[model samples]
Target: MHSEVAQLFRYSLGFIAAISFVACLCIIALAQVFPWLCGRRDDENAVQSMHSRPTPRIGGVAIFFTLALGVVFAPTTIVQSYLGVIIATTLLFLVGLSEDLGFRVSPRRRLLAVCVASLVVIVLLGVWLPRISMPYFDLLMQYWIVGVPFTLLITAGVANGFNLIDGVNGLAALTAIGASVSIALISLQAGYDTMAMVSMMLAAVIFGFFLVNFPFGIIFLGDAGAYTIGFVLSWFGIAVLIDSSQVSAWAILLTLFWPLADTVFAIYRRSRSKKDAMAPDRLHFHQLVMRGLEICILGRKRRRIANPLTTLVLAPFVIAPQVCGVLLWDHNRAAFFTVLAFLAVFIASYLVAVPAIRACRQRPQEA
Candidate 1:
């Protein structure tokens, strides 16, 4: 009986994986086709200035469409608990599409939409962490009151984090791919089937998008793609943290360390400068790398070495440690401490590296 049940479960998971891959392919194809059919080829012009060449930016439509279809075909139990995921994802897709169409929605309006979408998932759908283990306390109370705001902030932050990081080719998509795979692995280890399934599906979808996004740079994720990916990843992270018995709350913090740190740092930097907290800027770590890459390429050095050197050399140094920390530490307090230590090291490294890189570039051209 146990063997039969195990076999059945494996078969079901395999089926879902196959479907998700097919859906991703279909969505990418549809994304390529829809612009011509809908007579909106002009929008591609808006993106050409940002990218090296024009590519379709409305790929999120395909992603969300396929995701919705996947949800419809998912098991009843999985769909029931994750109904909020489906609804919130749809809302984000629409919000992103509106922005993509050249609607001048303010940051405040965008945040409000995100809050409402998050509330639907966290409050209405009842996907929230019931307890948090504090430093001394084994299990903290007041989750209902605390969890709601946390959920809203995380959901909105992740959505915007991806959006903000979309400045360079393959950066945001690579981060999303990392995040999706991490969340899926954690959820699977924690035995959260629904969360695992959703995360896996998303990972597959983003992989399809990345084929076009990276190196060759065929299509952009745009606002819609970013929003949808952010919303889903945020909710999945929350769901795993809240629903899993095996994973501690601090593990969630470690898994999402990069985005959370970047968001907080951006807000602090903006506040200190007396700028609108939500104002856009190019000071992000990835932006720094982009600047460095441009300088190296324009120096008449090998283009081949400079591009891959920036991405490969910097990514593992920064991203790998946090992921390794999440995987290694299981205890809540230990994980929290590790993350703080990691942050301290990262900040110190950034302060030293940024100035050194800038100074090197500022040197007068060789006579």
Candidate 2:
């Protein structure tokens, strides 16, 4: 733990994080000065948009821009070990950024981009899920054939998952902050200084974006920001697990459970309706909560208030699973059960509370 703290303050990492924070603030300020140049601006017209006015959505550029600078300042060995991943995530972010810039990138193409990035990272870094904590699966996972494809699928799914949950103002950024810190804390506990630093650096970079995003919604996470967050964090989970066999993959998954859960639920919901799984919709957990607040208490015209409020209401839901995961980082059996328990709660909230609110919203207003 002492080493973790030292590493945090040493190797110019603290300076890099501080610089990244200012860098994000600069991006926000620049966007305000020249909004037209900052990719696309979003309003309430799109199916998934929650904001009332058009806002610049290319905040990912600032994040990766700062992240690359951090890599340059990192120790040579750390950069050598992670350069391939940084490249992969850069490509992934650019592909999503193109979409954010009002280009014609489809969801299919975006998913394909993630798959390509995952393959490069896996091949270059040799990162794969060694075991799944299950018996037969563990035996199968030991082989690259099973592990490689499984890792690829999961990495792509998670990259897209972050995109799915970027509904409310602070939901994605805050959830990313909480999960990254959890990963860093667990990495510190396991004496993996590199992993801890990477995780903490990520948390710091995202926090800079969070300051202007929450409550006021001056800027947005956009496709690039959301996808990059998922891409990096999901791979960070794999990287840490490979670095230390003691770390539970289930625990790692728990750290990312909030967005991943929403993605899985989205796939299931879309499948039930015979729609393409990648098709966009407004039935997301955060979306439901936003609508609920508008219909029940805040009233529909109060969206400016309800949007960020939805993030606050669900922030605990994001943090709790991460805390549980970090606390049980090395306990596979406990973490596995804890994952199942959280899923139960997640699904119940989706099926019960959301539908109840949907019914309430559908009723005719009294004359």
Candidate 3:
């Protein structure tokens, strides 16, 4: 691998971005012009619904379609380089697309699809989670039995984690932009040129989707977009760790801290109540922040104001670890402890914020 990203790839970056941005606009325009044939529009009535309008939820189609076009028009060398990894994820993306198109795809089946995707990547791309600098545990990862499952665990966890956090406008997409840029910087610093270029292109894809998703919520990312972004980012982390002897796994973990933290918290919070782990709820950290904004400041009637505002409010907290992770990519001990410190703050904030907002909303009714 060259330390310098190919000049062709550098030029193709803008092309990749332009296609994604245009593709998303086309999807939205088509939905407006032909509503009956425009796939599925969200009802926004779930326990976690945040918007009031029925919006197209098939942004993934535009994203993947953009990627397909990139393979043909963009630099073929750059596109072919990551082709296998891209093909492996088709299963996970299609499973998610099924759900987005109002078809039933069970959680169990989705997990199975991602696990299969992980296995394919492990075999085809030769990418898997490498050493974490953990003493005994790091040694165990050398074996196929332990290593393969660890890879699958990470793959499935991140895919589902991003899906869970895709509740509010621009929430998932913005965090993805933050994470993708972080990964690209770290990959560039570590001399993984291919990974860096792909990471940048992924950021471009999400930016296209974000233009319509944020502030007003013209189209929802739905499950497909979230899963694809999460799966891609997680594997990017794994591939970077495998390629760079200097990059710390803990640093990658820090880059991905927001979604993983929220997912683990949601599981804990739900399990404590003896509820299904896969069941949807409004207890996610992002949701709590959105609700707090509505209750204390924006009020219930100002959803259009509060919806995207919540993403802006939480953006810094979500972006900090990603920036910090890039800075500490080579410092194993520092990155490890930083991840712990972040997890502590995130959990503590959620615990305090959720209840205080609950009480604030309840007090008016009690009055």
Candidate 4:
């Protein structure tokens, strides 16, 4: 126990120092370079939120490189064990960077690129979802056919989901930090030193990004940053689940609940509205919540504060599942049931809140 505590203390210091230094340097460099690197925001796409101007959307470039630097300099003995994950995540980052830099990469092409990256991770690293918590599902996943595709689907889904949730300033980065910290704790408690170190490193790097992103919105965590974060977290969650028997599947589910739930909700809502699932809209959960705050909370007098304030407001709720996951990490049955109940409550709240906000917005004109 003494040695374990010592190791964790050592890792914590190195993780914070390395990531913090790299993030600072990278952010300074990107602040100078992003104007040349990123194109003007294409608000016609309905993806860019209202801001003072078309700020740089290539903040992901800084985060990606800084995170890589932190990993290369990590105090862990098994840093090289993450080579496959790092490479695959870099590939996704490049694809996202290309899109941000005005490349006309279609949604299908981008999705395919993410899938290709996930395939490389699976083929090279052998990190795939082997089992879910349910006995029947776990049995089915024992077959290679079921397991391989299922793993690929989840990896890609998360990669895309990160991009989907990046519409709001600081939202994706804050959510990533919350989830990463939770997973790091879970891995640490399970004695997976490498996974714990890496997750904490990720959380620290993103928190550095968050410092500039929140309240003022000086920069954005573009597709590269968002996709890379999602890939890393998803990979880490899978690694912990596969390597540790003590960690319940519900822990992984809860770690990823917000992004996955948001993506699934968007797809279903779009399909019902006869729009393409990947089509951009301004009515996401975050967007609606912000709008609600704008109407009921901020009022017209404080409208400008809504964007940043909304991120702060929703961050705790985003992190709530991960907190629950950590507390129930050892109890699989209890964790699974709790997640189900929380998810149901969350959906109900979303349904009620969104329409209520819409009605609030319309009432003045109706009156």
lDDT of 4 by residue, 89-109 (tens): 778888888877777666777
Considering TM-score, which of the candidate structures 1 and 4 is the better prediction for this target?
4
lDDT comparing candidate 2 with the true structure: 0.83
Clashing pairs in 2: none
lDDT of 1 by residue, 1-367 (tens): 3353344346644554455445545645765666542224454344213343345566576567656766654546667656667787777778877776566566677777888888777656766545445643434334557767766777788788777766556667677767777776677666666566666667666766666556545556677878887877777776676676557666666666666667777888789999988887767765566556666444535333343345554566446644864485357667777778877876776677688667767776542
- Per-residue lDDT of 268-337 in model 3, one digit per residue for the tens? 9889999998888878888888778889887889878888888998999999999999999999999999
Best candidate, TM-score: 2
Q: TM per model?
A: 0.81, 0.94, 0.93, 0.90
- The local lDDT score (0 to 100) that residue 109 gets in candidate 4 is 76
List lDDT for all candidates, in order: 0.65, 0.83, 0.82, 0.77
Q: Which residue runs of candidate 1 sit more than 4 Å off their true CA positions?
A: 1-52, 72-75, 135-143, 297-310, 317-322, 365-367
The segments of candidate 4 whose C-alpha lies over 4 angstroms from its true place after superposition are 1-34, 44-48, 75-77, 300-303
Q: Per-residue lDDT tens digits of candidate 2, residues 206-305? A: 8877877787887777889899889888888887888888989898888999988988889999999999998888899899888999998888799989
Candidate 2 vs candidate 4, lDDT winner: 2
**Candidate 4 root-mean-square deviation in Å:** 2.6
What residue pairs are clashing in model 1? Answer: none
Clashing pairs in 4: none
